[model samples]
Target: MVVNNGIANDARVIKTAAALRRAGAEVTVLGIATAGGPREETTAGGVRYVRLPVFPRRGATAAYLRFALARRAAHLVRDPRRWQRTLPSLRWYQRAFTRELRALDPDIVHAHDIHLLDTVARTWPPHRCPFVIYDAHEYVADLAVAGRRTRREVESWAAKERDRISDADAVITVSPEIATRLAAEHHLPRRPTVVLNAPVRFDGPADPGAPAGPVRSLRAEVGVSASTPLAVYGGALSTARGLGTVIEALPLVPDLHLAIVAVPYPHPMSQELRELATSLGVADRTHLIEPVAAHEVPAFLASADIGVSAILGTAASYDMAMPNKLFEFLHAGLRIVTS
Candidate 1:
């Protein structure tokens, strides 16, 4: 059971599934099936994908228009109506998710995150689905819900996460921090495995046409003139990511332009960040680009002086939360500053 077969940008699942198949294991993805996925439903890689209804998201192509108009996309879903509208879609995703997994009859089922734990647990027949692994991507339990949800809502989600981690044959998390916390917080029979979310070691062709002339051309296109240094921040602009710090850091450097290449995670804080940049009089130097794919990251990182990854010390952050953006920065041979 590939619990996180949800998004194309979810490169971990995709790569893992492919890797498993290449290693002589048959893999099936229980995820949202977008138009971009192989139409045959199963890839030649011995990997099959089962589209979960709840995971209906527009893929990279649809991502093109995410930030448009005088306004870019909203970074957070702060409105009440959005939640009401989102509930029905959630139900569909659940139903589609359960049916497909049940049909797949995987020997070992792995659910990626606390939200899916209960659903997977209920779906698994007693003594069947022999191995259930609760893969905690982040600490759902510790997440401070934003905008409107009550403490009860958070408690319910956290409880479910706890149950999932406790009940699974094995609990797997991305970092030691989450692993240690899970060990202390739950009644798991044994310790959960900690698999750090490191970036794939790049073995691709070096310098894929990203040279000086093209780099300068990109600089010119984004209004970053020859004299300016570029401080690039890539990836989600969520509250947890600590993007405000990046904006605040901008005021210290007069000869720099801030290039943010990310689809702002839905939040009011993101809008506020933009406003903060404007208030600081650095808004003119802000170059906002939409999200790029995992593979295309080096190209994005190429136009930067330093890459920033600021995840304010969440325990759920398994082992320093080695987000690939940090790795991409390293791969692109750019300097990086993180918090």
Candidate 2:
């Protein structure tokens, strides 16, 4: 399996890897290594994780060049006339990515996103192609359309996705809505399979009730009185996630305090959130916490009076997404408020 993101906190990929391992398949996950993380490691589940070093060790030259090349490629894809200018840079990045992927030599290559498809395709031989499973986690084209990406970039990405899907042995998506849309968009021979991002199931008995020990301590640490109504948002601190809206609401809802558990990725929005909270005069009531282990998330949710998803409907992907965090809140018995 291959993915673009660091695999440490990718719940869906980890779950899929574990399931595949349990089904008696030897699984190896190839992903980009995060700063300060090991380049390679094997998990307890018997899945080998090999992280490709995409970023430079000390200098920013390589990283900047790669970014510039990616942008050039995007532009060239939209207007092929620019291929002469973009090809060299694009080839540099492609060669690096393909070099690492080719070392794996597996029977099947499961690509986790559209971004990795080009590299995966280029690495494997055309006549003797490995079984490729395009596991699209979201409608990336729509997502780019919703962001700062230009229409040309979006079209370029969409075209690439269509071409790759045509060659894929099978396609998999996170939701039925996405699957249907992808099928129609690409005019694929088969509809993509919908594998919902459901929360992991537990066979044990239901919780008797909320425990007071953790709740009481957590509240004290955050200076949230027992009587105060606390709402928790545990995910990326991005505008797309509607975290800004939640911060805006805090001033209006005088009695409520928001505990934001920022997702693992290094986010610039953390500063923005802090500024917004201070401006709104809700800084004292808002608590920003670092991300915790997956098993520890339930305890944090249980401590809150409510769980907030509030994801913006800027893109089709976000609009139709049945986010795992939503079910996580439900499983933890927190009342949900979604946008």
Off by over 4 Å in 1: 1-6, 32-50, 55-94, 147-150, 202-227, 264-273, 313-320
Model 2, residue 162: what's the lDDT? 65
- What would the per-residue lDDT of candidate 2 be over residues 143-184, giving only the tens digit for each residue? 635346555554555656766677678999988888889888
Assess candidate 2 and give its lDDT: 0.71
**Model 2 alpha-carbon miss at residue 293, Å:** 2.4
Each prediction's TM-score versus the true structure: 0.71, 0.82
Question: Candidate 1: RMSD over Cα atoms?
Answer: 8.4
What is the TM-score of candidate 1?
0.71
Query: Which candidate number would show the highest TM-score if scored against the true structure?
Result: 2
